[model samples]
Target: MKGYVHSVESFSTLDGPGIRSVVFLQGCPLRCQYCHNPDTWQMNEGNLVDSAEVIARVLKNKNYIARNGGVTISGGEPTAQIDFLAELLKGFKEAGLHTAVDTSGYVDLDDIDRIIDDTDLFIVDIKHMDPEKCRELTGRSNEKVLALLGHLENLHQAVWIRNVLLPGFTDTEKHISDLCAYVQKLQNVQNFEVLPYHALAKAKYQDLDLPYKLDGISEFDSKQLLQYQDMIQKYYSKKFSIQHDAWM
Candidate 1:
């Protein structure tokens, strides 16, 4: 099968464990205000690669993956290319490679299930706690995402939940507390990450000829994070830190 790809990072440390082959698939339905990879939102706008080619490259990095971590398929939304991912992950599994899918959780349950069957870990981005806010922030409702989480829980799949903590947009006290409460209901949640928003993607919006909505917005402060962290920690027993990579 063929998949549209925005780009590929051969060796990435922050994407997963030790070193990982991160495939940035193209096309997304969401219109996140703080999206860094604005260029990836367009469908069929990137390189077209065969699953066999991807698997071949990933196999060559097995030593690094075995030593560090594994391959993580990130995207404009990996579920958008479900069949391709299923094939790629199956091949990786055959080669004894650990596979992860980093997604927005906006997909058909059947497609997600197929990928999950071949996947080892699921790294998901929970856009918002409030359905209304979620719709506003991502151009769609969060019902599907919430349902995806519930499905993962029911299947006992390991998941790493991530939230972009945009100070004014997403870091409200009520929102954080609500998300904390919701996460408490899930099982097999391996980690929870709080990603603070930054203007690193402003240039991308400019290049795409799109308006950068969150312009002039300051990054989150230490105190703000502490307040939200304390609230989330009340529900989340596992502690997580802010990502420090260039992509964060």
Candidate 2:
């Protein structure tokens, strides 16, 4: 088996638990406005490597994973190549490695199940609670994403819900409140991470020759992020905290 891979980041820490190898799969179905990986959205475009070839490299980093965390698959939307992802996860699981997938939940439930059975963690991104706003922010509606979340819940899969806190897009009080309320209903959610938006990917957009959509949009204020974090905690606090240090 083979997969189209955009890039590989060995010894990545922020993607998942401890140390991890992040396989950035190519191709994404959703066009997110604040996407840092805009260059990865192109379908059928990337270096094709056989499963064994990739596994060989992954094994080299096994010690790092064991000592820290494990392996994490992030992507333009890893679900875009579902079967390849499942096979890769199977390899890692058999090696006794902790596996996690960072996804937008935009793929089919069948595909999700194929990998979820082997995956230990699901870092799901819920862009917006309002369907229309979700569609506007990311060219696709949240129906499929939400459906996938429901499936995870029903199957009792562990999940960490992530919402990129954007200034004008996803920071409104009404939206955050609704999102927190919705998340509270999901008993399977192990944690919630609120990521503050940064313009660190602006140069990447230029490199890809793609127009930067939120040019004038400033970075989210640290103070506001805490406000939202506190608000969300008020509703769902089993495990909720800022990605970095406490905002205040």
Candidate 3:
């Protein structure tokens, strides 16, 4: 089967463990205010590549990505093209490679179930903890995203939680506390990351003739991000069995 692919990165250290070949698939259902890749929102804008072609690309870089790395199918939401993602992950798994998916976790349960067994890890992005705020930021409710987390926990799937700290928006104590509280209950959560928001992609929005909703919102400094991370770690340590050091 073929999938709409926006781009590919041969070596990505942040998307998953070790060095991975990241596939940026096309299309997304959300119009996040802080979204950097507005270019990927269009489902039909990318090139259609067959599963074999994608697998071949990963195979070519197998030597470098073999140890702790493999393939990470990221968005525009991988589940948007469920069949292709399932086929790609299955092919990579059969080749003895670890596979991961970086998603917003807004996909339908049925689509996710189809590829769950073949997936090694999930980098789930929680846009916000409050339902209203989540909807305001991403044009979608937090219900599906949170539900996906619970579903992954029930399936015993390893997950890395990513929360972007958008200052004056998602950087509030209440938001972080609520998020940590919920995440602490999930036994399958392996890592919790706090990513600081940046306006680096503003130019991309201009190039695409799209509005940068986060315009004028200053980026958080490293120190501020560390403070937020410290708060999250402290809360998780106090509320969960997992140690504070487990967070990233």
Candidate 4:
């Protein structure tokens, strides 16, 4: 099956462990106000290519990626196109490349079950824990996301949880503390990160004729990440890092 692709990054260190070939699939269910790539919001708006084609292109750098990293299926929301994502993940695995899916975990269990076996890791986005706040930020409740996280925990799937710390939203002390505590309950967490929010996508929104929802919000200072690290480190004693411009 063909997948609608927003773009592809041949090499990326931020999406997952080691170096990775990141495939940005098209479409999303939520309209996250601080989304950096609003250009990828539409499911049918991108170039369509066969899953085999995407696999072949990524495999070209197989010697390096396979040895160091692997393939990462990221998106607007990779699971939005379940069939295409499954095909791509399966293809990556069959070719002996490690595979990871970076997603919002906004999809249903049955839908994502297709790729669970093929996916070696899941980088789940934690938009906001409060249902109302989450809905306000992304136009959806946090129900699905929570469910997906629980599912992954039950399966013992390796996960990297991330939250974009936006001002007046997810940057609150209570939010960070609760988020950190919640993550501690998971057994297979590989990484926990807080992506510093930035207004880097304002230009994209302006170009797309979409209103910059967060027009006045200043870029989140990278230094503020340290305070959060210190606060959450008590709960998350494993791997935690201050994510700069690297989170999707």
Q: CA lDDT of each candidate?
A: 0.82, 0.85, 0.85, 0.89
Better of 2 and 4 by TM-score: 4
Q: Which ten residues in a row have the lowest lDDT in candidate 1?
A: 239-248
Tens digits of per-residue lDDT for model 4, 1-248: 88799999999989899999999999999999999999899999899999888989999999889987998998899999999999999899999999999999899999877789999999999999899999999999999989999999999899999999888998888898789888888898888888888887789998999998888888755476677678777666677887776756
On lDDT, the leading prediction is: 4
Candidate 2 residue pairs in clash (backbone atoms < 3 Å): 18-69, 19-69
TM-scores, one per candidate? 0.94, 0.94, 0.94, 0.97
Model 2 gets an lDDT of 0.85
1 or 3, greater by lDDT? 3
Stretches > 4 Å off in candidate 1: 246-248
Model 1: per-residue Cα lDDT at residue 199: 87
Comparing candidate 3 with candidate 4, which one achieves the higher lDDT?
Answer: 4
Residue 45 of model 3, lDDT score:
80
lDDT of model 2 at position 179 = 85
Give the per-residue lDDT digits (tens) of candidate 1, residues 1-248: 89898888888877766789888888888989888998888888898999888888877878877665889998888788777878888988888878899989899898987777788898889999888888888899999888899999999999988888886767777887787778767878887778888788888888879999899889877787677777777666666766634343
Q: What is the clash tally of candidate 1?
A: 0
